[model samples]
Target: MQNLGKADKTTDEIFEDHLLNFNTQQVNATRLHKDINNYLRCIRAMQTANKNLMDTLSEIYEKEWVGQDMLYVQAQNNEMLWADLAHKLADQVVTPLNTYQAQFPEMRKKIDKRGRKLIDFDAERHTVQQMQNNPNRNEAKFIRAKEQMENAKRTYEVLNSELHDELPALYDSRILFLVTNMQTLFAAEEVFHSETSKVYSELEAVVDKLAKEVQKGTLPRRAYNRPLPIANHSAPVIQNSSSMNSPPKGATTDNLPPGVLYKVKAAYKYQAEDVDELNFEVGEIIQVVEYEDPEEQQEEGWLMGVKESTGQKGLFPANFSRPI
Candidate 1:
């Protein structure tokens, strides 16, 4: 029988044309596979980058800073979330896509084998037809040729039917698979963002509180000297005194300098003629000043300043006076 609109073309040529069209569909499916693979690769890269970023944030988080513990916890959770996402993508999306693409090569092989079988079956039929017109035709040879044709036809039909059922189903599954993958990705991202936002807000609150405390002077200023404890006195004293009764010789208000923080009343009477010590009576005020030589101030529980009453500059026990 002649194929419509191609009377000159043989059955084999028509079959080849059909195979070419099927191959075109296969190419489209292959392209779809590549696209899906590319998408999966990008997702994996993003997951790695996200995990690295979270790790970096965790590393930089100061241990003593407010919300630092919470930041560490959040970073761990984010890493786990990313791992879970990658796992799900691999199991539910990437693996299935790979499996689907893997089938194409085997299916193409079967299609090629079926075409070969069709050609063999046609050749056997033609041989039988030609032999039937021979004056000395052998019945056994004809039967053998007919049996071979039947076997070839049955084999080709089975492969054809299997491919016909499988190919269409595989192609149709692309839509469902793509939708499921996208839904999973978006859902995971939503969860990640929601959790991270809480962490971010908490950190912001901590920063605000710290800022307010600094502004109010409740937080200790950076780089300011901390009072040292003295071995002689029980405790350091803080007091406020405006002026001294009588300034001592060589110790004038001008000699005290602008660096003097304030004056403190002596908590205890100290009598020492040592060049390094300051002689002072109880109730006398001493001007506290920044040390000209920082090495001299390193002595524990001692400050270098001038006695406001006598204007004598020397070292004295910090715990013996109350800051004014």
Candidate 2:
């Protein structure tokens, strides 16, 4: 029998192209990674070997002895430091020692013959420092400061006494005088205002009285007849018996003709310039004009021949004589 599965070359061809390309890319990438990793490992191994070799060389160099010139320079520097310290300390010690030598020769000789005494050095240095610094052991400065403070205190006390004791009394006296003057002025102003008000009230009352007096009519009718100096003051005597009996019984002024004629009571005011002309007196008959409005009931009247003054005029109700 022949092989039944013959290869499909066309399909296989396309698939093989793709697979070959993919395999080529994967192989190239893997080869590049391996080369890089091998290069890194080699470089690290070289670095480790170089570091170990350097460390071994350094250890060997350290163990092998060099010459002493380097150490000699360091020793010379240490010697210089020691000499500087000795010079500085020698000056501080020499002064104290010399001070002891000059001031206390016995002590100085004993210290020098034996060794330098610590106590003598300390005492002399302390004494020299104290003598050099004058403010520390100064009695005169304390005395001067105390005197200055005392003078300042005395001045302050004197000024305070003048300000607090004497000046306050003067200020209080001036304030009291001002207050008393203000009170007196205020009282005088009040009194003046009250007196002025009282005078004004009295003048107003007098003027009102004069105006009321001038309102009464006393002029003659023709202006030619001599008016009596004053009107009659007596009450009228009624000759008719009908007028003497007080009307029939409940007859009011409204029911009567010539309603409620009554004589003027007294001379209230007249056409008088300073009371020299006619003055309305008690007996002048007045005609009462009855009120038309029943609610008011206020009586109105007209006087006969009672002339007004020169600058004044007589007044009357407009409906004085009309029929009720």
Question: Which model scores highest in lDDT?
Answer: 1
Which parts of model 1 have CA positions greater than 4 angstroms off?
A: 1-48, 133-140, 203-324
lDDT of 1 at 266: 82
Cα lDDT tens digits, model 2, 1-324, are 012343211122433353354344435434544553464455446545644653454344322223223333333443343344334333433333333224233422432432223223333444444444666756665555555545544554444334344323433443454454345434544554565455445535544554554465422122222223332334221121212223222224454334443222233334444332233433333333333333222222222222222222232221121211
Look at candidate 2 and give me any clashing residue pairs: 217-306, 218-306, 218-307, 219-306, 219-307
RMSD over all Cα atoms, model 2: 57.9
Enumerate residue pairs that collide in model 1.
Answer: 239-323, 239-324, 240-324
Task: Give the whole-model CA lDDT for all candidates, comma-separated.
Answer: 0.66, 0.36
Off by over 4 Å in 2: 1-137, 167-179, 210-324
Listed in order, each prediction's TM-score against the native is 0.55, 0.22
lDDT of 1: 0.66
- For residues 18-124, write the lDDT of model 1, one tens digit per residue: 56656665676678678867876887888799778878877875555556677677667767766776677667666776676676788678777877776666666
